[model samples]
Target: MTAAAVETKIPASAEWMRPGRVAVLLFAVLSLVAFLLPDGVLPAWTRQLPAEFRIGLDTWISAALKWLVEDATFGLFTFKDLTRGFAQLLNVPLDIATSILSTGLLDGRGSSAIQLAPPLPWIAVVGVVAALGYRFGGSKLALLAGGAFLYLAVFGQWASAMLTLSSIVVAAPLGIAVGLATGVAGYRVPLLRRIITPILDLMQTVPTFAYLIPILFLFGFGPVAAMIATMIYAAPPMVRVTMAALEGVPREIVEYGTMAGTTPRQMITKVMLPAARPQLLVGVNQVIMLSLNMVIIASMIGAGGLGFDVLTSLRRLDIGRGLEAGLAIVVLAIALDRLSQAYAAGARKRDAEGGLKPFLFGLAAFVAVTYLLALFVPPIATYPEALQISTAPFWTDAVKWINVNFFNVFDAVKTFILLNLLLPVKRFMMAQPWPLVAAMVGYAGWRLGGARLAALVVGLALFPVVTGQWDYTMMTVYLCGISVVVAALIGIPIGIYGGLSPRAWRVIEPAIDTLQTLPSFVYLIPAVMLFRVGDFTAMLAIVLYAVAPSVRYAAHGIRNVPTMLMEAGTSMGCTQKQSLRHIQVPVALPTILLGINQTVMLALSMLVITALVGTRDLGQQVYMALTKADTGKGLVAGLCVAAIAIIADRLIGAAAQKLAAQRSGAVDAT
Candidate 1:
């Protein structure tokens, strides 16, 4: 070798002493020594920070909120009065939606009021929905949407489902409007996006329960609070999607608009927005789904509907009732989710004069006739109760049957997982000195993304320790970690099967779609019925709620593998398993890491919901705060959860980037 080449290469022994590697190694060693040493051997601050050193962010937040509610003013009105007035104004849309979907319009009289119209006949609602589905996605989608509404009518859940729909109609549009406007603003001013992104992250990551505590105090107990929460919860995703969509618009399109002599305003409205319309629809879909999700969780705070029914049933341990309510939610979500997704997809291939338009109009005309007929026949307005069907008894019996016959199997599985995997992990995490965990995480961040990431991660990790919340934080980590591991084990294989086989993908596609659309709360029902209330049940809920992304991302990664690469592997005489292991797996590793990152995020978000199942973690802390109306406790605990998710997401994302860079480097070298 030449002298230059000899000088460039480092010895193996020296490689171990590279700065990045050495820093982490030193951290590990120092942490171990500090942890194992006598209690007083090291400074007292090594174990826990003094109370005086704590930031007291929670206390400061509470004080600020208090001042806002009591002392702050807008003109002649106090802040509370202004908010309540705005809330009352918000009621107009909600009242209109409620009147149209749930209750018939009523007219004049104290004792003898007449119905101007019966709430749009269930048949009408189903018909209109099916028409929309057909207009966008053809026959199969029509059947799906129509069938779902039909089930709502026949299963005796029309009123509850209608109430739920009412809130969604009001909140979804408002969320879309605000998100779109904000996104547009951000696009126009790059600095706005930089400012908004972190705030959006905090808003999206904070527990849904945390939102309620403040809304509860601000708006008092009513659907208005719920409506506000839904809008807030749903808007962040729309903003993100909108910003991305706008940025993704082809540069050529903008130049075309400019050549046409469009002004800035005209360019945005007629050119940019129009070009971005298809992608904007994707954001709309996300907004609607997230709105529905928040509305359901908001049910706990007086946004009464099917969610209320489900919540009540769970509280009563009425498995049969809960199942029906949960299924209704699932179908409702599926209908809305599928319609929006189809609408967004169909935008690209839109044909204004298509034959399907006629079919849609025909369906709409039939729906109008049903409303006309309902005037004369009240039974047509509402399905007859005697004829309505419910499979509650069957569901109850099924649960009982399972418990009697397979109790031992469930007990053994639960015991094995809890004792061997979950409990031990929790113990190990809690036993780690706070300094050691922080140092370890800092080292990881440094290795993955360097000094800035290391500083960020250390600051976030130490917050819980300083705040005296280490035990609960560890509890959350243990549960989420195990759930992610289990989900990966199950979902990754299924994903691989789907990826490698087009036939398998055909089946897996719809199944995962259904799973993804179902609300988080719905997962809790089956888990509760099977495991009862405990950390194990919480784990199940988190796993079930989080597993879909892993399956989806993994399959996408596998399917997107370059055809030429696969052919090369085959040409080289590689076996199917060998090709997957050596070629496809490495190529897909980054995307798979992204999937795991999503799984971790989803797991953390579910922590608050799992608290309802009796897990003692940061989630439980927020839940307790909600009950007592303690904003400080709730917000602080919520921040901790967000911090955990942000840290994990950033670390995993950085690692994925590192892997991709390494993969690219190797390819370039070859």
Candidate 2:
């Protein structure tokens, strides 16, 4: 036959030879081969890295940190001296804030002495907060703001709450400032973005507790150190959000600013920043939530506040006191989250009215009236002791009742889960030969992102093994694996319900916000109370801490499905379930996957905190290392956790990209 005739008869084979398809086939084959191999079956060399070839990164990091702390000097000042100087500088404001919040300016020496700047009375503080809320957000927010503070006072938690607030008052603004500057710089400079993006990713992934040891060493244990850690922990999200917001500003707005004869500064300040206000406020909200979340964790190193109260209660097994403090944290978080969201939504509307001056005047009037009342009504100034209510007894009785009635049931469920699910999965993961596991991961990475990603994944996987942290790392993976699965099971359905119904959305969204805003440490309280401190309880805490993002993203993705498509499906006589299954679910799958990615990261971040509830994962190693001042071990373990997160991020990110491409292709074809 003629060559042309033969070519015509044989259909083009190139479609089946696509890189993605080829990669997948290769991954499947390789993974199957690896899986079928005996647990210990590997070439001798692939079992572990040779001792001499190991990098000793831990030793180097420790040495560098040691030099910085002990020997490194800059002129007359050592690094420790410099860190302490900054800490002391920060301490001035913190001390003043504490004094104002707790003791007032009278110094508790004599009430008659001429007071310097006296602490604003509790009534005045509440009035100012409510006024500010109303000024920014209207009556509903005013009620929420007023009610939260009142709850603090009536519960006799005013002083502890104030202490926590004082730290947040100091930390949140500093975080915002630093984040804004860094974000702007990163946006303007590609090199800076490249340098800082990875750092921010690392910072976000690392557990908050992991930060405390390094900070404790540098600045010593105090509110200052806690504040610094809080800033570091909270600032990265703001930086990331700000950069994203700035980058996402419409090009036309910038051009408009330039055409209007605006300078570079004016363009950014007036055009880009204003355009980016929604996202920037979201970043601010994140900072506030994260700062509050850090409160209890920071208490571990001597930061005083409601967090300290909660910690003390937990240590003493005073579930009643712990719950009260935890609830206060939750209430404070919800109020701040709502206030910030409301303010962001209303800011543009208020700006259009040109009513700033009247708002300020009204605020000033409220403050003045409250101050006047404070001078006359001492009970209003400071919450009267006689009127202070204690719910601790009620909570204690509740806990006792729950323990008496429900402990056995919870214990049985915990045992069943541990035996039927977690233990087998963990053992299987741990028992896998390192070579086979690494090969499978590498192959999957190759399937998703070619040789470069494969190399990156292999390197990340090997790092833990080389550091002798493989067992602990696998333990973490097992714990996170179970948590993510359970979260997806719980969160995805809630997300679907919320997506389909506005009423459900309104109800679920706020609950998700509250759950997300609460501190990681807070989850441990109930877990400990109910399940009583073990791997099971720890997993439960991680699940609670990690589930919100999945639910949120799923709902968002589903809600955002194209109206035209929905209508088209309906015109074809597709029922709701049929339409959702064939249309919305397919389109939303990519976003749902991204939500799962976020859940994994959140679970990893919670690992160290969960260690406090007793789990022998990498988190426990870091915790132990911190207690012993073993910088090398702590840093190594933390890096291992970051590595796991990075690997998961890259793999899932690639899948999401592929799904997006498919979605685009389908749209184009239509």
Candidate 3:
């Protein structure tokens, strides 16, 4: 036979040697070896990880943080002194805001106390908020804003709620200002954006709990540290929004600005910024929302207000009061969300001629009159105690009644989930060999993207093992994975329904909006009250907290499926189910994948919070570290959580893009 004939008959090279085939073979072999081997038979080196590999990362990080707090110096000042001084600086605006909103300007206490001025009267605050809402939006917004504030005053949340509002007033502006400057710089300089993008990603992906420890070390425990943390957490999204909005400016506008002979500075400030103002306002709204969320977490660190109220109540087992405070937070969030949305929509974009002056004058007059009246009318300054109502007893009784009546039912449901779903998954995850899991993840990365992504994924997956946190990592992965899967299962179908029918969307949208607006901390309240404290409760809280993104994205993806494509399916004589199955689902699959990716990230983030309910995960490690002020443990574990998130985000994103490309190619071929 000729050489070519011989080669062909020999089949060239072994098919199993191909990278994709080899990857699967390695994955299966390792998994089998891991599962079949008796616990001790795999060798401690593989399961326990060597001490050298651990590298004592937590110890090193702790030492570094300790030095920064106690020993490090800059010029004449110790690091702590500098941090304290900055905290003091922050306190000025915070004090002023608190004074204006909640605490009257008073000196000393008891007999020696002298009132400098009263805090804004409850009526004045409500009136001003209503007027501003009307000015920015319309009468409907005015009612919403005014009613929310009135509810706070009437429901006896006036003081604590105001304290929370004050923190937001301080933190939100700081976030916006700093975020704006950073964003502008990033947009102007590509090099800076490269440097900044990763930092922003880290800021956002790291658990909110991780931020508290560093601030605690530097600034000492107080509202200042909390505000600082909130500002840092909330700023990243604004920076992203700023860069995106600036990038989206019209090319024609840019040329026009240049042709008009504007200087670079003027072009940015006068031309580009104005054109991007509407979008920038949206960034402002996002900063507000994030600040509110962070403020709740920050409350644990000494930030007083509604968050503190809830925390204190829960600690004392005052479930009713805690729930009340949590609801107050919800009302505040909804009111602020609606008001900010209207503001960002730029309802005043085309202000009527000569209307602005009269409106402002009238608003000022209304506020002034209310303030003056408060001097004489005590109830105007403070919510009338007689009119105030306490639903705490009712809520407490309701929970009691439900627990007494439905304990078996709730227990049965919880038991079924744990026995059938959560426990089995947890056992499987805990038993998996680290090496096998890493290989499987890497193989997924390779299939989705390439060698680079695979290596990155494998490295990330192995990090917890090397850091001596494998058990905790497994717990976290088990809980977060199960929670995300459940959330996706629940949210995606609802989202599809909403996307398909406008009437369903109208009903579903408000419910999800309410769910999304409530701070993550609030979800824990109900979960704990019902299920008490356990992994089951944590899972419930996580599912509730993370479900919004999945619903939102799935609905968006379905709604945006091209009309022409559906029409094409119909023209081709397809039934509704057939068209949906073949055309719509395929087209929407990438977008739905994105939603799952988002759900995964949110679930991971919430999993860290779930540590509160007592699942022994990385979140618990972080929380324990926080209580001990063990910066190293908290940060390392937090980063492990982040590593998992980044891995999930990147791998899923690659898969989405791969699916999208395949669909596009198929369409082009057709």
Candidate 4:
């Protein structure tokens, strides 16, 4: 083909080459060197370092950190004091759950006491859900809703699932109500947005463990505390997301509403919110996912049902039980996710279908099936070991095999990483003088964000050092760095290839969604089985969990690059690689940066769960605080993590904004 024809086919090529045998050779060399290198390479390397390095350089940093943690640092906040305060606060929820468990309707006394909440008659719920689905989309969605409810019934988990569902039924709407109020307030008032934004960021980024202690202490256990915790923990995302979506609704629509004699509330309800439905739905999805994610964690605080089952199974290392519970959770998640998604898609279908006739039929079918079974079959209780799916032999054999074969290999690798890499890197981060660290962070902020971002980042970075979590915070930073690096290594390239191919995106999207929805805890078992405990397994878990965002963002960024821009590159006689490198990448850089930012945030969020695998970081502190019921300690540690998240978010997001502005400015100048 002619050069022009070739250019039109794609774009200019940026020279690229695949390595031939280099990777294998490099690996061999590294392996050889690893054997040759003395294990003491780390100790000697650190031994020669100056004593004045990080220690004497950070006097003010140490003092500030010490002051921030003084109450906990000196053991001044006694466990008894914290425990007593928690007891006093648990009176209400404790009373309610106790009444349900101890004596009442469904208190397990008389035949009538064994039944609870009327089961919504099953028909009503299915009808509502199917109606919602039909209203949102139509036949496909109606089938999905009908099927999901049927699965619950046939699987013999209908009652327990419904009990869990009841909390969500209460919690989600409550979240939306709070979110709508907060979102409206945040949008209308600059000061409220300013205050709520940081809190929202903290809530979104901090591990769930941080919230549990406070909720447990304040409300005690059971569905109430669980509900309260779920609301508090999950509501911020909804509120923030809703506020952003609503605020972004077309000004013209609001003006039109005003011109049409609408009041402010009418404009918001009838115009802005409707126009922002896609984003609001995303908020709803986030709320559902977050609430469900916390369900298992909430069980630890006294919330019952599947979460409790999952917790019990995990504690006993009963993989079969855990898998069943996890599967139930996943099934519930899929049901809710598909049902909601269909509802969103069904909106268009609603215009065609006209009414609820189709939904009603499906609902009637579900009710007939569920009620007939519920009336006849005695309530299915937890099965005996013989009946349950037991992976004990398999998991035990697998763990034993790994312990025998890979233990030495993993131990050696872990030692090298901890001693040679992670420790020194952590020490260096912690060692930086506060002023120097602030200056560097401020510069990064200014370079990427501007003066406002720079100021915000510097302040956030300085806070944890002041709070005496400097060391622990540094450790979190290190783990995040490791996870982000690993995730990017895996995600960015996968995203690029997927972005280049529509067929790939189609295949990959479902996989990505599954990975994203899979609870972070579910992966821990396999990770521990493979890598054993310590930082390696934890890091691997974080990386695996965090990779989804990076891949998703990268693919989205690349795919969303304007078609006109691609055509322009082709018109200019550029090759595909050249166009991607010189044009597409530059334009997509801002969005790609956003993906990186997400990856970091997600990695940081997973750190607390990683702590359960035995990492001596802030996550450990948060986890320990939860078990000990040390609210203040947990809060401080949580804040420290929040500080880290906010600082990184500001820096990266600011950088992306700056780059976007620069690109726009250059385009404008041209």
Best TM-score goes to which candidate?
3
TM-scores for every predicted model: 0.92, 0.90, 0.94, 0.77
lDDT, each prediction: 0.84, 0.82, 0.85, 0.69
Write model 2 residue lDDT over 1-670, tens digit each, in one string. Answer: 2323222322232322375676667756665565467866766445456667667877887788888999989988889999999999998888788766765564344456556554667887777778778877889889989899889889888888888988888899999999998998899889999999989988988766666778888999878999998999899999999899999999888888989999878877888988999999999989998899889988888778899988888788787788788888888877777788888888888888887898789877877787678777888678999998888888788878898998899889999999999887777666555676788789778877889999999999999888877778888998999899999999998998888899989999889887887767777877888889888998899889999989998898899876756666666677778777766766677788899999999999999988888899999998898888777778889999999999999998887777766655544433
Ranking by TM-score: 3, 1, 2, 4
Range of the 10 consecutive residues with the lowest summed lDDT in candidate 2:
6-15
Candidate 3 weakest ten by summed lDDT: 7-16
Name the weakest run of 10 consecutive residues (lDDT summed) in model 1: 4-13
Off by over 4 Å in 1: 1-47, 106-117, 348-351, 354-368, 667-670
Return whichever of 2 and 3 wins on TM-score. Answer: 3
Candidate 3, residues 1-670, lDDT tens digits: the string is 2322222221111221354786678777766656666787766766658887786899998899899987899879998899899999999999899889988897875588788999999999999899878877789999999999999988999999999999999999999999999999999999999999978878888898887898899898988899999999999989999999999999999999999999989999988988898889899999998888776688999998998888787677677898788889988988898888887786446353347788889988988898999999998889898999888899889888898999999999999988998887887777787877887898888777789999999999988988998888988989999889989999999998898889999999999988887777778876787888898999999999899988988899888876766665666676777665666666777888899998888888787778878889999999888888889999999989988898999988987887777666545533
Q: Tens digit of lDDT per residue, candidate 1, span 382-435? A: 888998999888988898899889989998999998898887677666556777
- Alpha-carbon runs more than 4 Å astray in model 4: 1-113, 116-160, 348-353, 357-373, 377-420, 571-573, 665-670
CA error at residue 185 for candidate 4, angstroms? 2.8
Each candidate's clash count = 0, 0, 0, 15
Q: What C-alpha root-mean-square deviation, in Å, does candidate 3 show against the real structure? A: 5.9
- Considering only N, C-alpha and C atoms within 3 Å, which residue pairs clash in candidate 1? none
TM accuracy, model 4: 0.77
Ranking by lDDT: 3, 1, 2, 4
